[model samples]
Target: MKVTRLSSKGQIIIPKALRAAHNWEAGQEFTAVDVGDGILLKPKKPFPEKTLAQVAGCLKYRGQPKSLDEIEDAIRQGVMEQWHDRVDTRE
Candidate 1:
């Protein structure tokens, strides 16, 4: 078991062994949660959520890639189609 002494300022110095084990560096941010008898320290930053582009790796289509203009046009067309569909459904 590891031991740490609390200073006068209510700060506890994490031991070198524990720091090294957790790859914790000086000035690293952590979230301390009080778990009844003890505190749990966790990193502030978790892994980012996955996105469709990331899952696909690279786009499947081949040939001359669609330019920004083409992509924007496709998005506008899709939105207009959805809007018209909604309008038509309303009678």
Candidate 2:
């Protein structure tokens, strides 16, 4: 177990060894959880936000894929059926 002292400002300087072991950075955000009498400190996960362009080349859209228009039409057809609208299949 590691030992640490609380400063006058109520801040505890995490030990260098523990920080190095965890690869923690100066500005990295962490969460402290109270486990009964003791506490657990862990780094907060970074958000999984990503742009479509970033994931564009990484995805494999396989099988009989439908176009955007086809998907929209399918959705509209489903909605129409739900509303009991007689679908004019002539189009």
Top-scoring candidate (TM-score): 2
User: Which 10-residue window in model 2 sums to the lowest lDDT?
Assistant: 82-91
Best by lDDT: 1
Per-residue error at 3 for model 1, in Å?
A: 1.1
**Stretches of candidate 1 above 4 Å error?**
46-91
Native-to-model Cα distance after best TM-score fit, residue 18 in candidate 2, in Å: 1.0
lDDT of candidate 1 at residue 15, scale 0 to 100: 85
Worst 10 residues of 1 by lDDT: 53-62
Off by over 4 Å in 2: 48-60, 64-91
RMSD of 2: 14.6
The residue pairs found clashing in candidate 2 are none
lDDT of each: 0.87, 0.85
Q: TM per model?
A: 0.47, 0.51
Per-residue lDDT of 1-91 in model 1, one digit per residue for the tens?
8878988999998889988988989888888999999999887776666788787847478688889999999999999999999999999
